[model samples]
Target: MKPSAFEYHRPTTPEEAAELLAEFGDDAKVIAGGQSLMPMLNFRLAVFEHLIDIGRLTDLTGINHDSGSVAIGAITNQATVGRSALIRTSVPLLSRATPLIGHFPIRNRGTLGGSVAHADAAAEYPAVALTLDAEIETLSSAGRRTLPAAEFFIGMWTTALRDDEILTKVTFPIREGRSGFSIAEFSRRKGDFAMAGACVAVKVDNDLRVESCSIGLFGLGSMPIRATSAERSLVGCSIDELQVRDVAHAAVSGLESVPADLHGSAAYRVRVGATMVARALKSALEEATDD
Candidate 1:
């Protein structure tokens, strides 16, 4: 099936995109990589009268790193992000998660902002953002605003972005100490959506005690679940098998509200989620110790 007829507007700048969104209101939909949106449009799941194409907006096309954080432009392709040396060194968690997003061809066209905006429960970018406490920046006719990842994702396929706002970039803090990052997901095929996944970022001190830790779970809830309870439990604990198991249990304990679907039962998802968390934590611990 093809998308219904719509008025297409190619905006060269983010300001122009914001104006188009404000002019069209709810009738306007922004298109970046169009990987997710095009599928929804083709399936008739989403219909809009106006399509604002921001694919050529040079303002939203690069990755910039500073002393404090790394800012990734909204329209930057996933492939570019995955291959970036800056991201690999500064925001390694994001770099590790990018390859797990989709196949090479899909990543070539999928945008980082598109994935975050789409808010797919099983998407890698959102989970990474949540784990890293990233900030999302948006532009609108009223001006600009930044939202933490925790507040940006409201629900499944939902976000705090206003109708007249266009997401311009995402900023992730650079971990300053010895840090390790790991991503683990259970997918039926290489490019398929995950049944359960975990993203772990951990910083350990000289004594191997956790200085800071962030855990984000995907494919287990309405949105990416930041396993804060589990993180708190491991903050001062030594990285070991026993501590990892306990942390995994704490993370899964928050899955009391996860809904079951055709892929797995609630019980199965919880189990898989816990196992993924354990694996991720162990891998992160190894990397942290090595670092």
Candidate 2:
């Protein structure tokens, strides 16, 4: 099925695009890369009378890294991210998660903003953002405002972005000291969405004990979930004394609203999610200790 007829609006500037959305209100939608939105539109799952295409805004297309943070322009494609030395060195967790996002061809056209804004339960970028406490920056008539990843994602396929707001960039704070990151997931095929997955970032002390840890789960909940309790449990624990399976279990133990579908029962998803967390946590710990 084709999308319903709609006005095609190509706004050269983000401010102009935000204005279009502000004017069109509920009838308008912002589109960049269009990988996710186009599929929904083709399926008639979402319909809008106006498409505010900010694909060429230029203002949102690069990677910037400072000592403390890494800011990726919203329109930067996943392929660029994968090849980015800055991203790999400064935000290694993001780099590791990049290849896991669909296939190379999809990554070529899928914008970072599109993936995050679309907020798919199984997407890698959102999980990475949540794990890193990244800040999402937006532009609107009200001017600029930054929303932390924790507050940016509200529910499945929804965000805190206002009608007039255009996401311009996402900034991730660097993890200092000895850090390691890993992501683990189970998918039906190489390019298919994960049935369950976890992204782990860990910082260890010189004694090889956990100083801090962040685990972000995807494909098992309504929104990207931060396994905060599990993180707290691992603090100060030596790698040799840590039981990865137990921590993984704790991560999923408190989870509610995990989705159940033909892919798996809610129980099955929980099991898979826990296993992913275990695998990711183990790999991250190994990396941290090696460093």
Candidate 3:
């Protein structure tokens, strides 16, 4: 099957893209890397009347780091992001998770914004973004605005972005002092969507006390889930294996709402969630201590 016939518009500027979206409304769709969207189009899952391609907009193409945050352009490819030294050093959680996304070829063509905006429940970027409380900046006909990562992911294949809005950048805060990051996932093979996964980020003080912690889960929910209760457990605790395990356990204790798919049952996914959380947190804690 092929996508329904649609008008194609390649916008050179975000303003132009926004205007096109405003004009076409729900009938319009944006194309970035075409990694996820193309498949949906090929299957006739998305029937759009217009495709506004923003792939060439120079504005949406780079990684920038500052004292307080790291900002990545919406069209930045996963391969570029995965290999970025700034992302690795400043937002190590993303670095730990990126390699787990599909494979090298997919990464080269898949954009960070596409993955996060598409909001696949099993994707890596969403977990890192949500866990770090990253800010998603958007341009719309109304104006530019920033959406909190927590508010951005409303459900599977859904987001807070309106039809006229295009995500321009994703920004994650840079932690000071000793920080830890970890990600764990299960797949039938190296490049498959995870059956279950977890990401853990910890910031620690000189006294080995946790300053802040964020844990995000995927492949066990409708959207990337930030484990608030689990994160709270790590605050003020000394970063250690026992503490990490306790928090990991707390992370999945009440998660009885996961979907049952062919990959696994709800009970099995919950179990995987707990185990992955423990592994990720333990590794993150170790990394924090070493730093």
User: Which one wins on TM-score?
Assistant: 2
Q: Write the per-residue lDDT of candidate 3 for residues 1-291, one digit (tens) a residue.
A: 888898999998989999999999989999999999999999998889999999999899999986699999999999999899998888888887888988898999999999999999988899889999999999999999999999999987789998789999999999768888889988778989888899888878888888888889998889999889878777887654245566777898887459787778999888888899989888888888894
Over 137-210, each residue of candidate 2 has an lDDT whose tens digit, in order, gives 99987799999999999999999999889899999998988888999999888989898999999999999889
Could you tell me the TM-score of candidate 3? 0.96
Q: In model 3, how large is the Cα lDDT of residue 139?
A: 96
**Model 2 spans > 4 angstroms off:** none
Instruction: Report clash pairs, candidate 2.
Output: none
Clashing pairs in 3: none
- Candidate 1 lDDT score relative to the true structure: 0.92
Supply candidate 2's per-residue lDDT for 262: 86
Q: At residue 47, what lDDT does model 1 achieve?
A: 99
How many clashing residue pairs are found in candidate 2?
0
The TM-score values for the models, in the order shown, are: 0.97, 0.98, 0.96
- Report the C-alpha lDDT of model 1 over 1-291, residue by residue, as the tens digit: 999999999987899899999999999999989999999999999999999999999989899987799999999999999999999999998999988888999999999999999999999999999999999999999999999999999898999999999999999999877888999999889999898999999999998889999999999988899988888888888665346777787898957558688878989989999999999999988888894
Model 2 weakest 10-residue run by lDDT: 282-291
C-alpha-based local distance difference test score of model 3: 0.88
List candidate 3 segments past 4 Å from native. none
| lDDT at 204, model 3 | 87
Residue 53's C-alpha lDDT in candidate 2? 89
